[model samples]
Target: MPSITINGRPAEFEEGQSILEVALAQEQEIPHYCWHPGLSVVANCRICLAEIWAPNPRNEGKLEPMPKLMPTCQTMAQDGQVVYTDSPKAVANQRSVMELLLINHPVDCPVCDQAGECYLQDYAYRYGRASSRFEEEKIKQPKKDIGEHVLLYGDRCIMCTRCVRFTREVTGTEELMVQGRGATEEIDVFPGKGLDNELSGNVVDLCPVGALLDKDFLFAQRVWFMTKTPSIDGITASGDNISVEHNNGTVFRLKPRPNASINKWWISDEIRYGWKFIHDESRHVMPMLRSRDEWPSPKAAEAWTASMEAATKGLKSDGRLAMMVSPMLSCEDAWHLGQMALSIDPQAVIGVGPVPFNGEDKSFPGGYTVRAEKAPNARGVRRVLSALGIDVLDAVGMEKALSSNTSIDRVILTGNYPSEWVTPSFADAVGQERFLLLIDTLPNSLTSRADVFLPGATWMEKAGTFENVDGILQSFEQAIEPVDYCKSEAQIAMDLQSALSGQKPTVFNAAATRQAMASQAALDRFVSDVTLPKVPQTVESDMSIIEL
Candidate 1:
């Protein structure tokens, strides 16, 4: 490894690594803009200028500091490289650059959506002069709606060309471009088409200034006011990394949380804007048990116990029990459900629910992909069932087991899909012989026919891990409490098990459950306290790694 001296601190670097990259890896301060790991480096913005030292040609063998500052972003680190980010010359240059960037920037911090988390504000306070030198009229540029979800304020741009490079190099759409040069330079989309790619919202996150904004999250909430919880996107089996940003139990937005092994620095638009369903008011909120002559009470605990009694009353000691666990459930929930079923009948037929699929996997030029499989934890459900010594069945096999064998009398179904998963034909296939129990987050046609309907919790309202498409077990935290009367799938499973054993039902604790199951082969590597990789904030670095 090559070594570089930055601001009097020695740091090792890989071959061909730049000075800016090495400095950031060591958490050293070096102010920069126009450099993002996910995009190409234009080096147009001169904010990262730093003094460089090298052997002088004029002197025989003495080292001399370069008079002209070098852009640290474009300067490769050599074995004996010496870079000074805090030298008198470098400090003066940084201050001057900050002043220049703010010359035309409007003082609209009160109205800016990115005010609290804006890097420009942080750098200006640290490296800029107290007073302005410009007395002339400032340039004013009109804001433009460049895309369906992207809005652009031309004046706030520093011509870093990151957004432009993303469309060209990453998405390969080439929708955005630099329309002008120098003082009049601005970001614009091609005419007759907008920046509406499947991965367009990432530009707002890429912007260091308040130039680009997400239309959906334009004025939702301040960054400081919202609590961020690490989560996995439920849109696809890929399980792209994300952070659920909410305030007072209301989710305001979903943003990418970098995971070097999964999603890296970007996520698809589905992951960015697919959280609206979590807040829908029409979702089922209360557990209910449908008796032959009357309706059960709405009380969660009482209804939970009654539902379990009704569901198990029709079950026989023979292998007559069937369970369909949805792939949307976390591994812990699925495992608990399997355990509850096996406790009732050792040879119970357990299977995964219907998995939704759209078109084939769509691959982008930059190596990002949106998988065709829509479920988040199919691998997880299978792994859980296999660990419990239960032979799993698919939708077809489950139907066959019910239809071919007239002895199968009890059925339990669990799901939290974004769309209609239970069709009329699916209900027709089950026939009228078996009593049905349903656990779901939304109200579908299947709810009306179920003997026991248990309101289930969404992924946002629970904390657990999912084995993604790649079989990597990634954990997510609860963003908010379960909606009115709803209990988590794990909790519901625990309650059901308690009712069978004539024990009082208790709420499930995810951390404790994970610890208990730590010895299982399926969850051998499960970690409950997983967090997103750190987003370096010090400055000066551009290293892109897209693990799509």
Candidate 2:
């Protein structure tokens, strides 16, 4: 390991490691658009320049600092090396790059998708000079449609080839490429081709500037208005940690949080745009009691559950009472729910419902896409169900058992499906004579038939762990207050337990469930490899993306 001075602090790196790697590993952030961990290093963007002082060969013994800067991404770390990123020269260089990058860029901050988090916007505020030296006819290029999913404005581009590299190296589509040289270079689709890959949405995230924009996410909402909530995406197994940014309880965009073992930096488009369902007001928000029933308060909710649990308080057989576990649920929520169910009815029939599979798990030049499973936490739910010595019936068997008369004495259905996962006939036919409980985030026709309607907290207000398709259990933090009468699924289930067993369920300790999940087989797998997806690669630079 080479111990070097970074930002006036000691930072050590393995021999031959780049300065960028060491800087980012130390939790010191540097912003650059062209360097993604999964792709080959392309140091075309000179925005990451930093100053360095090394041993002078002419003097033979003394340290000699370079007047000109070097690219931190391409420069390997050396022992006893002294680097200054916040020096005057480094800041000036960054400003110059921003000025050059902005020369031909149109003023579209109000309408561009990358406005708030864009590198240019951030660097200009922090390291950018007050005024530009250039006063010439600026180069202008017509905004072109690069692909089916992406709109390209060449004039606004900083010549960051993130889109081009993503096509060539990640999706292996090679749909986007750069044409011309120097100041005239621009990104575009090949002769007759357009970017139509399933994962094309990722390019928009890759672009540090507004050059590549998603038509779906374009001008949808201002970034400042959206509060980011750490949540899980149940679309696929690439159990990606997600930042659910929303406004007024409505989700606007989703992006991958850097989880090394699972998704590196990019989440599949399935997850990126999946939040649209949350915006479709058809989502059942607030608790809806059985038909012709009114919404209940926290106190009223407990009373109803008390009466319902009192009826079946003495569950005869373990398998007589069934709890329907939804795949979209977080692992922590599922674990606690399973514990509550088992404690009430030791012979509880635990059924894991529905693991929706799109088709095959496909791969490109980048890491393979685990696409078979649509639900994120199926693995975690199944493992938790099996841990309780219960048989997890498939979706068909679950529906069949609920439909049959002798299958269960009391049944609990937990789901967050955008639409009804269980059919009306099955829901209506199941609990005509028996008591039925529905635990859900959104309301559905199936919920209307439930005797005990417990409002489940959406992903925004819940802090729990979820295991993705890769069996990687990731934890997320709560973002906002629970909408209407909804409480976290964990707390609601705990409240039901409190009603039956007289234990206080109002205080939910997510840490306890998180620790429990950490021991399980499926969740234990998250302790694998770790990596930094983005870092500064410029030496002689003190510029960083400002924390907004």
Candidate 3:
């Protein structure tokens, strides 16, 4: 294999990779801007300039130095090449470039939303001069409301052109472009058009500085104070890897985690802003039971215990019970629910709940997609039912069965959808005569008819696996605690199972549940094929503080 020497360190490289790419791959520091792996290379940011020495075959393979410093982002790596990013000449270029880029940058890090994560601040501190050399007044640009989800702080932009290129090449909207030349240059939208593309929120993530900001996330919380948890896209079947940034149990934003085979480096605005429903005030937060007259009984510990006992009482293998597992639940949750139902009655009817759809799947020029199927785990729920040797039914099939099967006197239904999913026809199919036990996160028409209503948790409050549209099994960790008095669907299932057996309920562990599922011959893939999220390592600072 061919290798290149970067800053005296030898590293192997593949053909056609840039010198900057090699440096990054080898953990060598090379300050850069205007160059993103997902965007085109403009080579406008000159901070990555490096001195290069390569072998010359014409001169008997002697090493010859390039005449001037080269842009590492555009310079392809060559075998037997020697690169210097820490030499006198390269360091001087870096200082000059950093100083130039910071000339017009505002001194607003104290108030900027990107203060903690801004690349400009980091590079300026490391590669720039201690003080400014310019005496003239700095150029000031006004903030613009460019799109519904994005705001542009023109004064903070260093003209990296990352946002401009994303709109032109990836989204193909061409709404953003450079409006001026030289020091007065600024990014602006077309005269009549706005940056309202379906994926417009991605511009905020692409900006290296605080130029592009998310309107919804602006002034919400500082990046340093938030905890970022790796999670999957719970609203769509695309299963885009995401970092859920939250502070004090409140989610502030969702950023795309780069998965080349899936969502790449971008996520749709729908997924970015769809998490608002998780904190809605109308969420079901407490368990409720219906009295003899069909009115909600007062909340009490005894009432809750009685509701759980009655929900699973009078158990026999009579095939008189039906359980509708929701697609919104995790694969582990679905499996546990299925096992609990089967334990109570061997011939119980198990079917998948309703799967929601909006429009056809939409694709972007950059290969990112938004799935029409809103539910995340429909395929997973179906897989669990199939493994249990039960025939799975769709929404229509479940409705028909509920209406046709006269022996099904007890039904257990789960719904954790973000919106109202109960339709009049489906509601009528369940009817008012039978005992209906509902585990849901939101209120709907069925909540009024349910004999026992248990508040369930959302995906953010649970740790489990979801199978995407492409049959990829991905796992996510819990980002926050469940809302008050709300338990995860898996916990609810476990509690019911324990109540039926007259034993104390144990804590629900998704990993343990998956391991138990893998014990089955037909469901062994849960252990081998599920892809867990990579846990990031934390390195403590070694520098000792000197007290003055």
Counted clashes in each candidate structure: 0, 20, 0
Better of 1 and 3 by lDDT: 3
Q: Candidate 1 or 3, higher TM-score?
A: 3
Question: lDDT tens digits, residues 1-548, model 3?
Answer: 89999999998999999999999997888998888999999999888899999999999999999999999999999999999999999999989988888888887999999998999888888888889998889999999999888899999998889999999888888899999899999999998889989899999999999999998988888898989999999988989999999988888899999999999999999899988878889887777777632224354455567767767663433558888999999998998898888888778888898889988999888888889999999999999878987887888898998999999988899999989999999999999988899999888999979988888989999999999999999999999998776789899889899888888899999899899989889879899999899997774645687999
Model 3 residue 379 CA deviation in Å = 0.5
Q: Which lDDT tens digits does candidate 1 get at residues 1-548?
A: 66879888999999877788899998787888888766667787788888988666578646777779999998888766688888898899988988888888886888899897887888888888889999989899899999889999987887778888889988899999988777777789888889978999988998988999999988888887888887887758987888888888889998888766778788888878876777787787776666542334455566655666776565434548888999999888987899889888888889998888889988788778878898899988888888888889998788778678777778889988876788776787677757888899877887877878888888989988777777777777888888777788888888778777778877677666677676776566665433433443553434576899
Evaluate all candidate structures by whole-model CA lDDT and list the values in order.
0.81, 0.72, 0.89
For model 1, the stretches where C-alpha displacement exceeds 4 angstroms are 55-61, 291-319, 504-507, 521-523, 527-548
CA shift of 268, model 2, Å: 0.7
User: How much is 476 displaced in model 1, in angstroms?
Assistant: 1.8
Error of 3 at 248 (Å): 1.7
Worst 10 residues of 3 by lDDT: 292-301
Q: After superposition, how far is residue 221 of candidate 1 from its true place, in Å?
A: 0.9
